[model samples]
Target: MRKTLLSIASLLLVAGNINATNIGYSKDEISRNNVFRLGSTEKQGQAMRLSHAKLQALKGKTIDFAEFVLGSKNVTDKKMHVFLTKQLDGTPIAEGTVEVKKALSKIKWTLDKPYTITGDEDCLYVGYTTEVATTYKVLMSDGSYDIEGCNYGYKDGAWVDTYGMNKGSALIFVNAENVGDYTDAIIAQSNFEGYYKAGDNCNFSACFVNAGTTDITSFDAIVEVGGNKTTQHFADLSIKPKEGYSFDLKDVDTSSEGEQSLSVTIANVNGAGKETDTSDNSVSANLFLYPKTMERSLLLEAFTGQDCGNCPGGHLNIEAAIKKTEKNVIEVAHHVGYKPDMFTMSEDPTYIFFYPNMSSTFAPAAMVNRNTYANVSTTPIVSATDVNSLLSTIYYADTKEPYVSLYLKTTLDESTRELNVKLYVLPHKTVPHNSSIFNVYLVQDGIEARQANGGDNYIHNRTFRGTVTGNAWGYLVKDIKAGQLLSWEKTITIPESIHSSYYADETKNNVEAVLKNMSVVAYIGEFDQNDNNKHTIYNCCEARLGESHKQTGFVKPTDVNSAEAEQSVSIFVSNGKVHAGGAYDRLQVYNLAGAQVENADLTKGVYIVKVTADGKQTTKKVLVK
Candidate 1:
């Protein structure tokens, strides 16, 4: 069903001819724009697929306007379809079909309504569809660090994820905040526990705020706890009004392990200058430093996808965990390492560059709190055949008191298509590490997509759509103090043109599932600078999204048999024939990297396949073309 996009593009906007902000790539990211299929180009199909190289970075941003640096040649078909589609599934998002009589330079298309994208999937497609093939030139640019090319195509029925490599100078402008100076310094938050280990040199910090209202040159900070005081004089902490800085007490030892209280005071306000409010200078939070250790909630980073045959078992265990002790676990399902997923956050710094460095290269694998669970290697995760054993790992995590507690408050305006997220971080103890960070992500629930083992009707949840603001690990909220209260507010637009959920019937209203299924998840933790035990999710919590109840929906997990594991199945290829053996109930073939490939006329290469019988699974390597 080829549907025309609900477009809001205008033909007249070049009043003064201002240069559009190039959405392809930044100067440092990739600084070159080349003309690919220029003036002589014409539509080869109904739609000419275009990919913006760095479009994923604009995931949570607003797209009010866009520019296409192209010249329209002599065209018979005046009607054109200009649109944006999801990179993973090539689902059309925003678009405008307009007619042109004369050729022009630097054509511009403005959406009547702004498009707010939640899933900045594989690509940001800027394309146009024409029923009658017409002449049009498509712009191009250099390959970015993240993408090989910047354009794509959709024909017949299926979409080519990497159809062709091309770039375009399609500049998309969004409503952004202008930067200003920093002034008004106020005490924000600190991590002060009530108790601590004897002789424990705890991490303590005080967060300071200086927006542009005042000219705060510098400030002196003092962290006192357990009858011990640590004073640090900050020289030039010129902070921006839109941001705050954490001042710290790195190694403050506790007098004893019984009870440790902390208070953070800011003297020399604005570098000893006069300030109106002396009352908001000091702040403190509670913490308990146990003699041995404290209980911390387990963060289950489940790497799953519909294409993973064995992932069903992992889901069963996670569902059990959710039913058993939901608070004891915070599950984040990363839909990668299989097929290109609609919810995979490949744009995330932690996902693209960090988490993979420490996790296994296989699906159905999990990182329990992003740490070595059961003393197993980060790679080759311990077997998860037993749900009880997998559930028991939380015992260790449950024993540790969270060093931080996060609270969330959100207000959504459906009429204006605006989403406002408010985050509050309360520190329990001073974690003096300089590399502390808080990551808040928006997740969608109940996406009915294809799955390898659970059939094509698998539902995905806790799917990381993108970051709240652009920060995956958040800003420098934890760089200075552990037990301080850090508060932040982010306003993002909800795009109307994005794709709807696969199972739209399951949703009560709203075609776009992101807004309805969105959930705000926050985690305040520390990263080990030494690369050992790196990227740890200390404490985590979630806020139910869409208080406005504006087309709200949630995808519940499907029930699977927990008493039995996925049955064993095997596959082998011989004499150009794929064979399924060993109690096999289903035979699924894939190329070496795990993409589903046809079995009839096979290619010549090492291929991995899944053999499943009665939900049981096994993998085998074979040589096929």
Candidate 2:
């Protein structure tokens, strides 16, 4: 998904003349990663409409040719029909047909007679239609980087906007000519940290495209923030037509606090003052600055499965990286991508949707902090072999401040096999309502499982058990104010089935859920209801059951401790006996099956100790060793 939406005011204007130039929707090179089609035997087609702003420069120009790219096809009878229309589903102003030949090959159809643009029409539609018997995928692209007025799929005789549906734009373009000379530079994309701290030096970057016929030799970039402007110049460069150059501006001042709007503009193209098209020369973004910085604990959500032969390498690489950095890194291994195993939870499939495209959906892949780190892949998904990139991202992300801080506490009931968790969210700045979520995951360590290459009885740690928040995307909260403390409590029942292996006739039992080996991981992240790829974690923390954990961010609210002390009931194990402290009305013990044990001979194992004080109840897991 695009980080920022491009409006008509941000679209580049192109000149059309006798010197024909290819015009299309995609700004990047087309690399086939996935394919799309309506259905077998059904006419599959894709179309693009030139925006009014883009057509202004070509008002009187003519479209001489229509070109398109297609994926591999088996049927020889399928013919691609290309058409140009003033309106969708309208009579074609110009049409041509070509035989489908090779894969990833560009097929062109020279119009019998050129169709001139009147500039009165709202937009010009260019599309191709074809029918296949069994091979339905007729079009292909890298991924869904939707742009308005582009990426329309024809289905059931109606054009549907496939935005956020993974239906990438069809590789179709037109050769328009007959206008005049023009110079234009547009910011195709921009990047910067999501959040920053006051007084920190921020960095910014953008991809500038030469949208005109003239080559760009010199240019200037200006960044404005907080009423201050900084200009950077570049010279002795040659950027040809339809080409892009990326530039980075480092150490921009970020002294202003609160959410600040930053704008970047391209100026003096070829050192000839402003270009003819200025609408696309500038882009703006919002960045938040916090008064203080918090120490961040990164979260690594890994995708793997028992049947994956290369999965063990991913585990070793992650473990080695953690040991080398010694950073507080919390990991959750999801049993997905290759095949489902006993550890595969109901929500595990949903996590796979976090992949930017179908190509990156594979085992031995992981998302660090759910962020697209600088110099890394454009998407959050990274291969396990890129350990250095992973480390660099971890270090870079750790230096940045989070918008909110997370604190977690967990209590386990061995008898009822329930885990209770309390999550506290402290905001450093005001957060918009329904824009973020809090995710809680139950992960266990020391599980013996079969590994494709490492042999049976492989110890799998940080195995995802389930979601404590019920929803895989987490719980959404209301508007939050700075210094406000918000908390959520949830009770999760642990199933006994987790202790057994359910992988391909492998009968392994007694893989106990050791109390000391289990932990609850929680984090706060920004959520986009429309696009999962935009979700990024803000902050995270982990807490083990029946133990104390500490994290640095905000001071723990004293009122919470006071309230707990007033109704506190301490349950502990010592000298092979379960001890209960503080005043209590009743006390009892039970086994893992929720069965009460009355004065039974105890052994070296685990038990659930429950106590009721002043009508309030609490449970704790006790281990006798």
* Residue-level lDDT for 359 in candidate 2: 46
Residue 51 displacement in candidate 1 (angstroms): 71
User: What is candidate 1's lDDT per residue for 1-625, written digit by digit as tens?
Assistant: 1111111111111122233222322111122243334222344222222223222323455656654433343444655566666643455677776664443343466787777654345445555543423333433232221111323433444433322242321222222111122233444333353334456665555554442234455667777776678777766544433234665575566545434567777787665555433454677654565434333456776666666778888788767865676555767776665544444553432552333354445566555655545344543133344566556555544544455555565666667666666565555456656687677777777877667777767777777666777765576644545434565656676666333233234333232545667777777666754563555566776766654211111111121122112212224465566766335577778886668977776768887777777666766677764
TM-score per candidate, chains pooled: 0.39, 0.62
Native-vs-model 2 lDDT? 0.70
Q: Residues 143-243, candidate 2, lDDT per residue (tens digit)?
A: 53443345677776678766546444567777777556667765654555465667876656765666676777888888887667898888888776656
C-alpha lDDT (0 to 100) for residue 51 of candidate 2: 55
Q: Go through the candidates in order and give each one's C-alpha lDDT.
A: 0.51, 0.70
Clashing pairs in 2: 16-178, 16-179, 17-177, 17-178, 17-179, 18-178
